[model samples]
Target: MWLILNIVVVFWMLIGVLCLQVPPSEFWPAGFVAFSLPVPLVLNFLFLIYWALRRSWLLVLPFAGLILGWTYYARLFAINLGQEIPKEAKTLQVLSFNTHIFNAYDGKQRTASGVSEEMVDWIATHPADVFCLQEFYNNRNTGGYNTAKRIGVRHNKEMYFSIGEFGRKYGDIGIAIFSKHPIIDKGAIHFTKKESINRGVWADIVLEGDTIRIYAVHLQSMSIRAADIENTYSAIGNEESFKKESRNLARRLKRGFIARAVQVEQLLEHVRKSPYPVIVCGDFNDIPFSYTYNQLAAELQNSFVQAGNGIGSTYNGILPFLRIDNQFHSEGLKAYNYETHYEMGLSDHFPISATYVLEPKPEEER
Candidate 1:
């Protein structure tokens, strides 16, 4: 019986690893399986321990499963010994955050009057050389807070703001990129869905002697409200209510997976054609184990895996372990001091920042 259970667990672990390779567009269920990978990972570890204690050959099954999924494990957790950046290297500090519209709305209602201003002040004072903000808000109305104006003034940087269709309909809120370096060019990747609040924007900035493109992206969100979570939790004891709530949540997740699959393909198309080295920063709205992260990581280096320590979870909502925010860079750059700013609790998502230095060109290439 124990061996049978161990075999099942190992099979489940393999499926979780397979989820990384399968596109959610091709198989939506793979997204959900990938999101729950941590569960099987823990279970397989336990089985490995159990079999090893008994000196049973069964240990090999769990061991092989873990070895197969090691890359995904590293994506979710890291233990870097740390490295020193050379003092002479010119570094660029980049910060990516989903501001949740600066806490303007708490659920369906507006938050306290002064809350948005306070959050804006905190961000404006932060010392990052470039800021990639999702759910960024800007208003030009009299007496309204103009977030871009405030932060741009503080950084004194060239700014690019792309207001999506949804942002245009609901108070000029979208994604923004602000850089201390001069922006030589700027553009946006408009998703096929016209009403999507999520979008991608980029700026080509000349830093030191080279030009690098910075991409700020916000992918499709699950649209799972706090109320949906609350309802699901409250309905736990009642089987019928629980089933209904679970279905509702699952439907939202499915929609998000499908939408983001399409959206990411659009973003990748832009990424592949870029003439300059790229640094992508944003709220991906999907875990590192999903297709979205894998597709990007295939082409770029993930900063968290390179420089971060521990399970670098960036979401600060009801979900406990979610590292949906990320910074990915081309091989020409090296990332250092990647941090998830848990200290700043002003938004549903915490801000993440990293320092990067361009790699020295090879003598042959030079």
Candidate 2:
């Protein structure tokens, strides 16, 4: 039994290693296996405890697995205890949040006023040099809930937005970026798919004589409907119904993973060729361990990993452990005092912010 368990441990570690690299785009099975990387890490810890209780030599296998996949562990969670908080005039504070289309309009959680009111109030008070919002809504009705324009008017900032594929007709729900500095240029890169809500928008903002390109992206979502979630939960004990619901859920997730892979490649290429240093922020809708995050974050410094504490989960949903929203910056910039604001309950995702400073250029360049 011990030998069999050890063999299973080896195979699990192999799967983790395979997942660290990109999976074949044409194969769903590989993507499915890649998605299971998080599960093996949990199992390894459980197996380590079991072996310790038995006082068995088999404990070495799981320990080795953990060591082999240390990169994934580091990215998923961190403890930046006692790290110095840098405060300087060069520091730029940035906030990124997915408003979930201001859930007050959802008709389910209808508050006394609405989420839009709370969000607008928060933005006015909690100051940041730049704000990137995903799933943003600009309803013309009810006197137009134009968040970007409203916030810009109140704060005196430049605002730019890219309406999603669906938003083109509905005229709401897209990605928006607001900056205190002057916006020299702005544009959006729409994904190839006709139905994909995923799109990326870039703004070249001039800050203190330096021009930085900021990309606000909303990647492909799983598109799991409320009805699908309800059906899956309600059919838990019914095997046939549960199986059908599970298949539908898995299909949506698989398609999202594949589509994001394609979308991110193009975005990364554009970022790589940018003339100015880049800061990428938005709801990736994918976990840190996934290929989407790994690809897009190639050389960029993840703000959470740099300064955030605890598990640093930005998601406010069933699985609170997931950190789908992120902020990444190129080498010239340093992230400090990263925070995930769990206090904001207006949306399914908590807001994340960080202070950043641009490193001085080399004397030779001057």
Candidate 3:
């Protein structure tokens, strides 16, 4: 049985290596596969390390390769922060925010009236060239206010929103985009709405004397019921799921995963058709190790991995170690600086922003 487990372990590691092929593309058709990818990654790591110490070096080849390969990629992947650009960026400073329906937090205060003040101040102070928000709300008829319009008015940017599952009239249920540059066009790509909502927004902005397509998105949030949350952790607070319920929980989670996979594929299809280079930034709600990030990031460069330090976990309210929020750019753009704003007491996800210089398109590469 022990021997069989090790063999299973090697095969599992092989799967992880295979998954490296799926880059972060808009066509992320692999659903919960994104959510569950870390399982094999973790398992393989432990087994290989244990085997390495026991003179079982030959059997550890697959995972050993995976570990070494990622290390190499990481070193190669480091963003060049100090490279000189030809000129000041006609570059747009885009921002992605989930806003947690404005129900997110810092640490002490619940995201309500008290938190709103600080957030509004933040918006007023650091107005992004373009802002994409998720879980936003607006209800004009019901004595409601359009968060998008209000924020835009505050920051002097154009705003567009799509209603997803909950609100109406670009009110409360969809993703939103706000741009300092003229918004040439914008809209959303919706996914399975049976359980959770999934969608991404696209905007065409006139920048650097050209139109660039920008995608601001929030993929399906990992569905966690009260029970799932409780069972997925131990008293020690490490991410140790209850063994007894692992199978059933995994099945339920897989459904959510499938839904997200479909969403990713739709996003990819939309992006592929655009006539210009693209930039994608969002609160993906999945970790860096997950399939969702990999799929969407396949064609683009991950700003976090490129320019960020430590793990940039956007979702700080819960499992804060998982780096889910990111800024991704077209292959033609190179990020020079990136930061996950962990200081603000606003939304649950950290605000990730990057300064990038456009790498001139070479004739052959173009």
Candidate number with the higher lDDT (1 or 2): 1
lDDT of 1: 0.85
RMSD versus native structure for model 1: 2.3
Better of 2 and 3 by lDDT: 2
What TM-score would you give candidate 2 relative to the actual structure? Answer: 0.89
Write candidate 2's Cα lDDT for 1-366 as tens digits: 865776686687577557646643556566666667777777777887888899988888888877877777777677787766455446678899888877645476423235467776686567899988887776544344556666776789888877763333334667888888999999988887464447888999898888889998888886777688889999999999999999999989888888888888888988988999889999888888677888766768888988888888887766558899999999888888899998887788899998888877897249
lDDT minimum window of 10 residues, candidate 2: 104-113
Residue 252, model 1, lDDT:
97
For all predicted structures, in order, the TM-scores are: 0.93, 0.89, 0.75
**Model 1: which ten-residue window has the lowest total lDDT?**
164-173
Tens digit of per-residue lDDT, candidate 3, span 1-366: 645776665565455545544543433433334344556555556666666677675545646546644632342224445554457555666666666666523346432333254564565457467777777654443332445545777678887877775534323456777778888887777665453336778889887667878888878766655566566554234434355456566666565555555676777888888888788878776666555656676767787677766555667665546666778887667775577677864676767777666555676346
Q: Select the stronger candidate by TM-score from 1 and 3.
A: 1
- Top of the candidates by lDDT: 1
Please give the clash total of every predicted structure, in order. Answer: 0, 0, 19
Best by TM-score: 1
Worst 10 residues of 3 by lDDT: 71-80
